[model samples]
Target: MIPHDRPVMAEADIAAAAGMELHTWRRRHGSDFRARVPVVNPGERLRLYDQAQAAAFLEGRPIPPAPPAGEPHPDDLLSTDEVAAALGTDASTVRAYASTGYLPHGTELHGRRYWPRHVVQARIDAGDQRHHPERTGAGRQPGDPRNTAPRGRRTEARVQEVAAELARAEGEALPALTADELAQRYAVSRRTGERLLAAAREYLQQTGRGA
Candidate 1:
């Protein structure tokens, strides 16, 4: 029982009360929120939180009741339905894989095969990423959802900026910036800078300003 005077709770208690994993709670409610909760430690690794703040955070939120003691964590074992939804495949396919000992899991739980989350994800990652059953024919097609180009008035402005950066280097012994330098300046990847330079050169040529 918590002492009424202090009413401090640990991180584990917070997680249990919030129905979330420790990491999940930390991710969703970061340092700023943690400060609001007023987590404190007197040079110790263990953090103590104010119970009032924690209760306030969960005041209006609806959370499912925690499973009975001795049950496994919700994340420890995943149902075939969950695995199917995650992998974008049907349950039967996942079941078939599990039946053939493909899924890295142990015995079934409550009449459903429970795949170890990490193992199932590892196997899925090792396989083809574009092998979703519903997207077989459209995976490589243009206008495919995956390949849609960025659109908006900002595109032309971006292209102009890249062109200006390139033009600043014309007739100079050293270029205005290398691809890596441009990437750093614009916060884009080096490959993106290279592609932008290529497109900028084309745009300049079309505008009769070719270098």
Candidate 2:
């Protein structure tokens, strides 16, 4: 019996361990095998199976039950759907937060970002009424500094400052700041970060410093 802690095995590797050709196993019992042992990674080109569960399925033994699905451990990596559930919001909202750099940059794996349970909980504890302004029970004020995006001479001054920083940067890539990094550094929105980067790049090019 394979130990639960053993590393997951790919389908081909599992077939090789069972002394069956990969094609033969696929033709005969592939569906049954997959149905019995949950695929640890579903969307990847190569599926992986938990070693113990795969072993149990191959041996015609009862497969162990999947882990309970309620509360997750602090260290557990959670999908956007899981995060949505935890936050009492929706997956779209979670994705938006992630895209906007409002959430901590989580681990990216198998073409999906999985945030640690603790980080999601921390966001919950911190409360994001600013992000969801509707919860504030008041319409957005036109004069609100946050609503009135930064512009005019002050913005141009910042652009010039960032462009100077770009000139000082030693890398081949000028303005060495990603949109997300710029947002965090300047305490602005992701959209503002993009605008600042664009303006800075233009400023650098106009001054012949970026070339």
Candidate 3:
């Protein structure tokens, strides 16, 4: 009986040894035997995890793509539809805003009117507060007599002078002046200078002298 048990135990040991040998062979040769074994290095695994996280975070969201570099800023110019969308209104409301001076006046380009995007955005940020009676402080209302129109008239005259100077410098072509040059000449802020230049350009166009 002891001899019989020894042979059975020997058989079990042989089976265990065969299993170990098979595992070792698989480790050495199974890689080449497979058609394609996915090998994910640490960097690739990390990237995959990051992508999964980002995908999860962006789930159920429809985000717009970022604008390309050097592309014109959306705040620089707006289409009628864009203005309407921003204002939570329709295109007709935007047109009315422009006509009523609530929004900046726009120019017709290629038969489509486009507002200066910054101006419209500024007005919107101001809560469409232009000419709001409730927002008016104790200070005199716009066009009040206490405020001298002469100052504005003087500014207008100065604008025309600047325009003439520009015309003289570049002939009737009326070359565009840099913001710094306009500010130095007109004693105005750079922003004010830009507005003045825009107004002057409008004047030139109306008078058929913009050539």
Candidate 4:
């Protein structure tokens, strides 16, 4: 028995009766609603999606950034010219040093020679003075007064005793004993012992006793 002209309630009117607007109710509680929806340009949608995925995967984690471009490693080898520049010397001097075993051997790459930077620096710091023996009294000329000495049987016996003692203690054959060890045994300073040992070893080597 309804009247044919009566107005039917619209969905909006029904929602209003329930204390909400239909559009707002659908936006907030609709079964098909989405939260935090992104609005990206068609051209940028893929990029945005990739970024979102990366961010989600990396959440609560930290990663180190890559090294800057063109940075050199600490252990990188250096050229001979580079080594000379670092040591404040000429390339010829570097070669001479290398020949005398004062410096580490260099490598040839693509027909160019190079030395390790750290190895060169370490040898430099070690005060390797093998290149200039004349400056260190290590190259006394033949027939020099320092080469001649008063020979006595007692002196010969003492030298042999000291040499044997050093060889036994170190378990190695000695062209000569080190100054520090000789000084400890002789109750003398290292410098004095070094002078005496140098002279004795030189004489012994000349005589082919400990060659």
Model-by-model lDDT, in order? 0.53, 0.64, 0.45, 0.45
Q: How accurate is candidate 3 locally (lDDT)?
A: 0.45
Question: What would the per-residue lDDT of candidate 3 be over residues 1-211, giving only the tens digit for each residue?
Answer: 0111111112112223335343453365334422222211122101011222222222423322322235445445456666767766555445545654667778653224567656666777786433332424644345322243356665676566455545433431224566676665444578977876777777676767664
Tell me the tens digit of each residue's lDDT in model 1 across 1-211. 1122335566656666778776676667646456555553333224555566667666744332322234333345555565767777655445445534455544452223556666666767787553254444522333222233344433454566567546534522223546776565444589977876777888888887666
> Model 1 reaches what TM-score against the true structure?
0.28
Preferred candidate (lDDT higher): 2 or 4: 2
Query: TM-score of every model?
Result: 0.28, 0.43, 0.28, 0.28
Candidate with the greatest lDDT versus the true structure: 2
> Model 4 misses residue 69 by how many Å?
5.1
Query: How does residue 203 of candidate 1 score in lDDT?
Result: 86
Which stretches of candidate 1 lie above 4 Å from their native place? 1-75, 134-211
Off by over 4 Å in 3: 1-75, 129-211
Q: Which 10 consecutive positions of candidate 4 have the poorest summed lDDT?
A: 40-49
Off by over 4 Å in 2: 1-27, 38-51, 55-71, 130-211
lDDT of 4 at 72: 43
Cα error of candidate 1 at position 138, Å? 14
